[model samples]
Target: MSEQRTVPETETETDTETPEVVAPEVVAPEAADAAAAGLPAPPGGSGRSRRVLAAVARWTAAVLVFGGVGAGTAAGITAMERTEVPGLATESDGRWEYPRLSLPALPQGSPRPFTDGNEGEIHHADLRALLLPAPAGAAVDPKANGGWTTRDAFLSAYGKEDRPPLARALDDSTLRHIAVRAWTMPDGTRSSVHLLRFGSVGYAEEFKDALIASEGGGVVPDILPEGAAGAKMETYGDDIDVPDTRPYIYQEPKPYGPEQIRWAYIQAGDTLAVVRQSRKGEAAHVPFQQTVTLQNQLLG
Candidate 1:
């Protein structure tokens, strides 16, 4: 009986020592928290350990919320940029359909409304809608104008068989497209603007040189009738104060009639334009004014 009681006491002591050894592991988490807080671990560090765990949870949640918000904002911006809007997106063929351009107001009133085609004439099968350039606040009346592509047709309308300068300008090597617009002035006289869009700038320059050389003394005739009289052509160099101004040729109506008319031709980029301003009374510099304004529009 004494030997059995001594064995039971030894077993009890072993069990007690085992718990003491394992007790330190339970407190290990508390000790780590104290160290992280820059404080010496206390004998009982459970409170500090709970505080550290709570702080870590809050920081992690805050990081996730902010990160998610930032990512969502970035995604929204990307979507907006990719969205298609008129004038913002290009076609598959790489053409940007620009918005209707604002033009300068006419002298009589606001510009005439836009039209699909001019009256009394037809566009070529390949001819697209006219994309005219005009100064801001000025108005354009496309319906009031008519255009023809063939050289012979153009001459027939103008009542002229041939003019050397204009014929050279119509050569296929230099000319790519020829269109004209005829608008009625406020005074009932008719005015016309010609658009000669060339295939290349080199061709345009060549056409300009030919026209300038043909009209001796830098004069452009308002009308090139076979038997015209009193044709007064004026050549302007640096004296004309205009933006992107090139050498300009102005021709007053021949015979010095009561009807006032002025004609001019100027080049902007790949287009060489002819502008004729006509009225029943005294002559005005309307053609020159339009030329300068149109050039500014082109530059823009």
Candidate 2:
């Protein structure tokens, strides 16, 4: 698998600007009866205090949901203490495991709609995981105004040429519902891949449009994601370009897995590349060469 980049893969990795302080959280006052009843607080707060209250409220709700005695919202906490993830329970040494993605990469723009073995193996239903710290250069832009991701950065990572590869190969007619799972590394590095039912570029375009709008704060996250009420996202490039279907496209934020995972769409190769980064621990970053090699083997 030879990943001969028509474009020279940069020797340096992207680093992050220091994050701006999130406004201090403010917890709206709860009614005394509600407090006494121990009903969960309505989660609207300004800064850090709001965060603390929200956490407490979630624990209380979890307890109630899990039905723990002396338990209020804390049931979730207790359950989590006793519970174990199916695979995460095993704490092997720092080894990287590529988890199969749950979705297929929309590649209408690529020479190959799916991936070829020589260029890079298509990572549909697979993911790469590691315990390593984020690569030295990855960091979230503090001034991105709490943006989801930056466009210049994404282009730097995914590039315009890559976008065409996907556009060229994917079958717009086959697309059904397209879903995306994205993750932001604590160090500010981010990654994501769009999932779709083959040939359904409509969903893909709709998603891209939604992302462009949301990234600019022209739209809000809660308006679309009935599931996610408050989190916000940001974008980095020119508005998503999907013509013939809709003149405009904007992306709505999506949720995948648990924990604060930051995700976004970046055209990596013949397929959409999905990258996940954790906020607290080091994100496992494969050397650019390794990533290219893997992609070429999978896609070539």
Best by lDDT: 1
Taken over the whole model, the C-alpha lDDT of each candidate is 0.48, 0.34
- What tens-digit string does per-residue lDDT give for candidate 1 at 89-123? 43342111223444333335322222233221121
| Candidate RMSDs in order | 27.3, 26.6
lDDT of 2 at 91: 39
**How high is the lDDT of residue 131 in model 2?**
12
TM-score of each: 0.43, 0.24
